[model samples]
Target chain A: MTAAATAAGAAPRRSARRRLALVLEPYLYTVPSVFLIALIMLVPLAVGLSYAFRDLVLLDPDSGGFVGLDNFRTLAADAAFWNALGNTVTWTVSSVVLQFGLGLVLALLLDVPFRGRGLVQALVFLPWAVPSFLSGLDWAWLFNPVVGPLPHWFVALGLMTTPDNLLSSPDHAIWGPIAANVWWGVPFFAITLLAALQSIPPDLYEAAAMDGAGAVRRFRAITLPFLAPTIAITIMLRTVWIANFADLIVVMTRGGPADSTQILSSYIFTQAFQRLDFGYASAVAAVLLVLLLAYAAVLVTLRQTFLARR
Target chain B: MRAHVLRRRLFRVLHAGLLACFLVFALFPLFWLLKVSVTPNDLLYSEGVRLWPSRITFDHYASVIAHTEFPLFFRNSAIVSSSTALLSTLVASGAGYGFSRFAFRGRAAIVGLMLVSQMFPLVMIVAPIFRLLSPLGLTDSLTGLVVVYTAFNVPFATFLMQSFFDGIPRDLEEAAMIDGAKRFQALRLVVLPLTLPGLAATLGFVFTAAWSELLFALMLNSSAAASTFPVGLLAFVSKFSVDFGQMMAAGVLALIPVCALFFVIQRYLVQGLTAGAVKG
Candidate 1:
């Protein structure tokens, strides 16, 4: 019964209670998660933000005083910071481009009907399950001059002058981590893209086939458009995520061979963990947060404008 | 007509070849890890880039099991991940169900809050989380890791569970309710059984995430006993002078559980994921 009936005194109070409960059900259902996230994530996030403006070193008891923007000032002039910013761009772009391109190819391949497709899908997607840190280490091992075949293959293919470890080369060192990242992350793109592909109506293809469209022509006319939105969003999300991702870099090179691979995130890690510079690390983190938010805003606006134009 | 047939045949060959390349690219490093893990010590250097070792031995695996702190780390990882998965799933399913079924007050606000959690650099929160947990004596314990991981995972897990819940018809519970069962009771009796695969998918995803987490595991747990597999594996890497075979064996061992969980859950992943806010 409606609240009107309850006011008319025809409905029992038990049914009224049930109605009230129904009204509150969503709150009751979601409150636990909201509470937990508030306590664990938001509280700590507040504390972390507080650290950005304060002088808080872990080992130093006397270092809890407020130091407004001092670390940010230091950051402005820091050469390592500048280098890391440049490297973050290079790393994020290369990793996303490689992973996305390769993943799309893989996804399209899987979308085709074939024998053992299920098993093959599972196998290809297996790399996504291998822990990021392990993939980093595994790829690092694969590039080791002594044991791995990659460097040997590189030499044989005439791509390298010697069978030397790629991790030690300052110029090409970033690619090592990027390659590993591509290996680990391609499955993520493939899975998402394949999901998108599966959702595409099959009869569209059948209809196009009836119209005498070639494979490439039909794909260009249909598949690409269907995948565009998925591609755009995935690229944006993965770009931000890859920029923040530092585990592979840290594990493989520790920002390596003279900080060649020190993206902003890994730089933050090194400052915080290795040097115990929490305040500075948090400063770097705050800057990164602002940068990411700005990036996200731009991407969202671009997507909006693009949609409007379409 | 014969030219068209030959072109199709050529394209088929090309596709097969490209797929083979992808398969090798995906699987080769894993195969190398396994090969190294099994190669006998004498043949390790002698093998030098060979696909298969002349001699195979389980000594590395045996040694890793018998003579190391890996078992303790493995156990700790399992405890933390499983606890995180269970707790996150329980809490997230409730939230997801609400989101899926209702359009109530503060729904948008709550969703925006969860999305905010996904936005920030989580490293920013590490120090603060450490400070918050340390005073409560939660640091260096598996429980600490579980709580943190559960919170970290809840956002994605909620979205995932919401998708799964969204897929299920609400009429199942409504029909039960019409027969005099409470809504919660109907949910338990009628709806819950249907969501088992969805629940399993969420559980396995969260488990895999928690198991592989390195940074928080490193920061929160100072003790060897509390360190998860990632931390232990990282520590093992520093001992490069020590047997390479044993290290790879530990890496292989670490890869096993998550891979198995993922293999089981992979089918559900796309469907469950696509149903929710996967676009964002």
Candidate 2:
């Protein structure tokens, strides 16, 4: 039928209908995805926003009534919320920078020819497949002074004066989750950067090497420029992602020995799960969503201006 | 010439040494997990910092499998992950084919919307999803988790599928159409088999993602019947507070399916990833 319609010797109306169907076909294919995403994601996002304006408790029968802005009002004065906001910034920056740095080094290393490269690549990237929750628990065990080696090693290296669970120290507790976050997250960046590295033409390096460029000089001139766009987008997306990643923090410290490791996402989890305070949790989640959107917008605009300048 | 050769030799050795250090750093925590899981309860603390256990035992694994509800959790997770993988892959491959084949109106709008979906803090929707699911008899159900995970996974999976579809020649499908096969028939007969690697990659990604999701599993399923491996492992953390061995054993089991899936899909993922990067 399609061939007949396209042959230009067939009925004009039939060909028009065929063209119309071709136009509609893409929408027909996309309908399921759009419908599912709208139903499961957007509708909930709208409902969740509405939830922030009302009193919503899971167990309380009398809590459905609107108490507009009350959750936000309480959040303003909540000390833990404020601390969590601060800790969130620290956590996001530290984890992103460390993960990117280590991942870049790994990607660069793997970009070259080496013996057993496949095996080394697989083993190095294995952490990315470990469930985040398990990664959290595993690291928590490693930091335990009793059954694990890390703290004892730390003491021996003089990083600590005595063997104590670093996860239990309020002054330094946030580092526990950050360490696990960096370790688990490094593989994600490495894989992405490696792919981006592979896409760069080899002659860019070869030509530079022929001109007597040293390793550091070649990286600064050839590699860094090529990786910049990927680095920007990856860093932006990962910042937002790591900010919302509360699992490691929640599992390792449960928001801590004294709520010291509490970040905004974990606080939201605690409220929604433990206290059943859906309204406050949704409110905090709303704040996080808004902040992330702002961050993403800024990044997009910056990249736009950057490309325009170039 | 001698100095340059010496420097080059040193560089090679340094590269190997640094790579080895990273390998150990990456594997050490997991190595400890396995070591702890196999260590006898008596030696768990006594050989606390040992590089290896004095003796090994599978008692922790046996207890976790025989006594605890981990087997049930594993079954639930398998059901959820597999179904999620199949459902998401089917829907996404369709969307991907559409994106790849058609230059239709509203394509940009649809792609933009998909990107927007990727931006939000998904935790914001946890409570609302719980509310939405419970009324429909979906809470504490494998189908509920499947539905939730399928939606979460479809956007990225669709992009992956689209890239795979893009890699295929349009002429192949056009030839099928000219040969009297319907477009759907052409996809099924000609294009589908060729995209098997991409489909495998999508399934593996979705399966691993659903396997590891914990928050919704914890919130939506209060009953033991619907608990996933992560949820069940957390329960053991509290129940067997003193038995690190058992907890690690359960943790190791949770890692198995995902790790296996990872190995299967990593190569396809490399290809899909490059295509995606180049396209978008």
Candidate 3:
């Protein structure tokens, strides 16, 4: 009734000026955001896209000339690009799988009635609250081979000999950041899934119990299906985050140990900022943009399907 | 009934044990941070494998503050983060409201473009951004960091704020308009009041993001005068030796503003501020 009344009363066509004002209202609210976004975001992006085609120097602006896919050609053969690409894939896959796995288990456990539940929830969520850089720094310290608690304990227990800096080893450097990423990222997955869990009706579980369904069977048949959409969205978001994250790498390894831990983002940083290769960096960025666009398309499709059923 | 009771008790015990183990795993790092920050430098290696240190001191904290450039870094970080948060929230709120309410030309494209902006790695844009800012004399300035952070943050922040605005009902504005209010006045009186929680959340989110951002800060600013806390922390690790005590102390101090900010605005952070603002 209120919707109908508001719709009829504010139709605005009663006066031409009022109608025009109504038409302009939405645009006015949007103008400031649109202007800032255009200037700071859109224009820079256009500039970047153009750079992909031009030979550009970071220090010398006047050096840029239309190169016509030269940057792309260079990146295609670059050994570092392939290596970084491989590392990025490995990093994203491992981190996402472990994070979701741990998060789902934690969420399931937290879903059950238990003592100190609130305290546990708060404690688990603490890592998420800490800044990512600080969390990375904290882990960097804990994984320090010289005086870190973890390595020290391992040495004393005869687990490993002497000082072994995880970040200094090619095989383990990436894992240090991966561990920190999981520590921080698990909470997001847990919270989102927990919210979804709370919304699942208890009657379904009761019905399952009455049918003598075991706990694993009930979870598989009842819980998993309902949680699929949330889980999918969580994975998509985390994949994008993990793929692009550079802070942890910068803090823990700085893409070091012979660039073993270098992912695409860090590689791009090195190319652009460290090497001052503006044109190449833009091309690399454009590649990342393409990958992300594909990811976003899948996400949109998933959201549509989920919403359609709802 | 007795058998059922026994099974239920067993399940409870299992749940308790699992959660307890996970909690310890999750919290061990934070506990270790505190433990190491207080452990004296000499005992750091000497007290190997011990759960608790035999002794603790505030000397690290005292040295970090009094002897280092941490205070300047803290001040610079404060200025940059707070400004970015305030500006981005204000900008995002306005944009979000427009997106939520208006069906203007190119609106969808604009939003899609913003999403595209978010996908590219910041590393890709760093050199171009630096080149773009250098001519404007923004390099090595705190204002440069603010501009960069605000640009990077505004899109996501706008999306977040738009979700909030979408939750607010259009009826409130219509009713106010019916009672003889201009559109801006109606928005100011009716809509803005309800957007407080959203505004607070956006501010807190962006502030924390800018506070810890390092790449742009490192690339854009070179001098200690303009360096933020993250960059300042890097200064503690010289070529010859890393002062773990001072570095950890600085890391601990950086948590203060973030913790205090979260403590103050956590009500908005946790609350589903959109509830009751819209109808299903």
Candidate 4:
């Protein structure tokens, strides 16, 4: 009777232990990644956010004390910061619209099966592999009237009065980086959209076609709806990314030709690195982060509502 | 009937025309880089607008390799990129499996945090990261770069891997577990082999990103001994603004590894991303 009672008690104890293990299993698996990210990324992020309120210049050893919104006050009156904010909007909007439009066209083109499609896809997507700095340099060289064919072609096409570099004109210099951005970014959209496109069942298109739908009608009815979610997410993510992208502009222009190409991101870099004003840089960055979060929140809400209605 | 045939042919022509336009747009910049890299120094200015040079030479490539610090930069980049890729993939795979298998508490919140992490302006953290790493002796070191890059890449890599894991059936690992293997062993013996392509895809994506990173590399590593290819090339550009041929050659060298990686993995990249896109 005592041996039977001990066996029964141990059964419950062992099963309870197993239940506890099950509860902890996922945390065990995820702890390493979460720990690393917390230590390296999130901690730095918090510290960086805190730095915005302090005078934390890189070289000034005496600059770590908190300044209580002085940086934001200074930023409010800074014309360069304001100009950069404007440029940031212009840069993000133009780049995203151009990339999305061209990428969508490329995706639709590749959707149809044809001979040599693979070769064409590989060739066209090659630009995405070129490092951004290289793309910047390559396009900068191409826009140079001294070496590249573009200025000459522009003159021949009657788009220019003379063969001159497009990157030297402050009014038009932003387009130079924007052009390079489109070239490099189109492949990303194409790849994502193509994947989404391919996932659509062929019979949906066939059914729509059989119901007296033309290409435009079928696309409006089926393709657009099917692609709506992917399009929304991709565009939202790409907008945020391109807003923060400064490598091309920095490399190609250094925000030069009268600070015309200085987006908020490059402005932040310039402030932190060139001027060593980390506090002000972080303030500007904090503003940018807030704007992006607001943008993302809006897009997510829109996507939700659109999906819900469907 | 003739009208229908004519309309179809017109559509075909329009499609091919657009494709050709894209091809030319995509290739023109690279072609120009190649053209300049090959043109001998004497003819660089004289044949500026020429589609092809009258003569081509390997002198630029030879000079960049033999005379510049590009080789050191290339080695550093390769080391940091590969290490980041391998490390991020390993960490992400574990997290990914957790996300895929378990519907535990706070799962949505964790995923939300990751998504928000991807949205922030990384420029904000540059100074903070420098300060954080400097005290730990990670500043001006390759190890510092690997650690930082791995953290930045882990979120996206985790998502990529989770989507891949979600594609896999749970029964395979369950069966292995039922046969007396531990869960980790079942993962190693059954699930991992099936996810080789996913691991490879994550590796390629992370490697390319780490290879292309310029900002942090410039900020953290000031010493030429630890500089990455992008920073090295930028320094070269400013120092030798006149050496177009040598600079283009260095640019070409930078392009090789990423292009090769992209070629191998673009197919799987599409597949992996497609899975995520549909699920979302």
Scored by lDDT, the top model is 4
lDDT per prediction? Answer: 0.89, 0.89, 0.79, 0.91
| Model 2, residue A117: C-alpha shift (Å) | 1.1
TM-score value, chain A, candidate 3: 0.86
Residue B198 of model 4, lDDT score: 89
Sort order, lDDT high to low:
4, 2, 1, 3
For model 2 the local lDDT of residue B95 reads 94
Residue A79 in candidate 4, Cα distance off native in Å: 1.5
List model 4 lDDT by residue over A183-296, tens digit each: 999999999899889888899999988888999999999999989999999999899999989999999999989999999999988988899988999999999999999999
Alpha carbon deviation, residue A198, candidate 2 (Å)? 1.0
Q: In candidate 1, which residue pairs clash?
A: none
lDDT of 3 by residue, B1-280 (tens): 9998999999888888888777887788877777777889898878855778899999999988888888999999999999999989987878888887888888888787777666667666665677788999999999999988888888878877876777678998989999999778988999999988878878988998898888889888999999999887766654314667667777788887886675455445434332311121
Please give the range of 10 consecutive residues that has the lowest summed lDDT in model 4 chain B: B271-280
Output the number of the TM-score-best candidate: 4
- lDDT for model 3, on a 0 to 1 scale? 0.79
Which ten contiguous residues of candidate 3 chain A have the minimum total lDDT? Answer: A191-200
Runs in model 3 lying further than 4 Å from the true structure: A1-14, A59-63, A111-119, A153-163, A198-226, A302-310, B102-105, B166-195, B238-241, B263-267, B273-280
| Chain B TM-score, one value per candidate, order as shown | 0.92, 0.94, 0.89, 0.95
* Candidate 1 per-residue C-alpha lDDT over B1-280 given as tens digits, one digit per residue, 9 for 90 to 100: 9999999899889888888999999999999999999998888887789999887999999999999899999999999999999999999999999998899989889987886677676778888898889999999999999999999999889988997888788888989999999889988998899889889989998999999999999989999989999999998888763577998999999999999989889878877655542343
DockQ of 1: 0.62
On DockQ, the candidate that comes out on top is 4
What would you estimate as the lDDT of candidate 2?
Answer: 0.89
